[model samples]
Target: MKRILPQPLMSLCLWLGWLLLAQSLAPGDLLLGAVLALALPLWTVRFWTEPARIRRPHLLLPYLAVLLWDITLANLIVARLILGPVRCLRPAFIRVPLDLDSDLAIVVLAHTLSLTPGTVSIHLSPDRRVLLIHALDVEDQADLVARIKQRYEQPLKEIFAC
Candidate 1:
């Protein structure tokens, strides 16, 4: 069952991605898309790992929404700093110790942080718990840490752990 459906779904997404990149939906392209929808995953089996199985499907959209909004806001803030005649950039590297220990939670946290405009996930400790983040504008490291904990890590714990 896993092999059957996951393969097809993967193929379908690959097909859709190709279509999107091409920006056309003509009849010949449709045929090629159908071929890709059946062939790509079969050809790429050894390269693919089993995807991370998200436990809470209900949290999916809300998580996406949170990420989208954060990305937009972060982009605007970063743009303002960059476009200003005098850039008031207070760049700082902060070591944020994380309490959410689950590997999935950590993955989400790292990805979320990197996705935001001005923040980059510089490094994760060997133990995979502590994250070293670089913020483009770090007014107060404490406030940034608090925001990361409250806005992302807390909800990640609830969604993935609790």
Candidate 2:
């Protein structure tokens, strides 16, 4: 079973996602979804170096809520900065030190930063100890770094348990 379904949850999600996107209950669609659900994971499983293990699954919901709220607030702040004055913008590149050792955790942190408005993850150091971020407007670099560490990184560390 493990050999056949390397990632059972991922397979299920892909199958459901395919059915939802196709919007059909036809036998052909069902078969195709099943095939894709099975085949894709098999093909890509080698690329996954570490099996994703969520230590605190219960915290996922609250983490997502915080992420959504932050994104919304960031969107408003970015809009104001863009509409107000380019001269007032204090664009800067921030280096955020990582406490996460897991590759999956680091990737998630990077993606979350990129998803938020006004910030984009530019690079991850060769040792993966630091993540470089480009922000559209930064009033205090230290504050931004602290916020990112506390708001995003800490939650992820707990969830991924890295």
Cα TM-score per model: 0.74, 0.86
Write down the TM-score for model 2.
0.86
Off by over 4 Å in 1: 5-51
* Per-model root-mean-square deviation over C-alphas: 3.4, 2.3
Which candidate achieves the best lDDT against the true structure? 2
Q: Which tens-of-lDDT digit does each residue in 14-85 have in candidate 2?
A: 999999999999999999999999999999999999876778989989998999998999999988887876
Clashes per prediction? 0, 0
With candidate 1 superimposed using the best TM-score fit, by how many Å does residue 16's alpha carbon deviate from the native? 5.5
Candidate 1: give the clashing pairs: none
| Poorest 10 consecutive residues by lDDT, candidate 1 | 48-57
Query: For residues 1-162, could you state the per-residue lDDT of candidate 1 as single tens digits?
Result: 656545754576678887997789998887898787777666676765545445565876787798899999999988888887796689999988889767767877999999999998999999877899999988899999999998888878777763
Task: Note the Cα lDDT for every prediction shown.
Answer: 0.81, 0.92
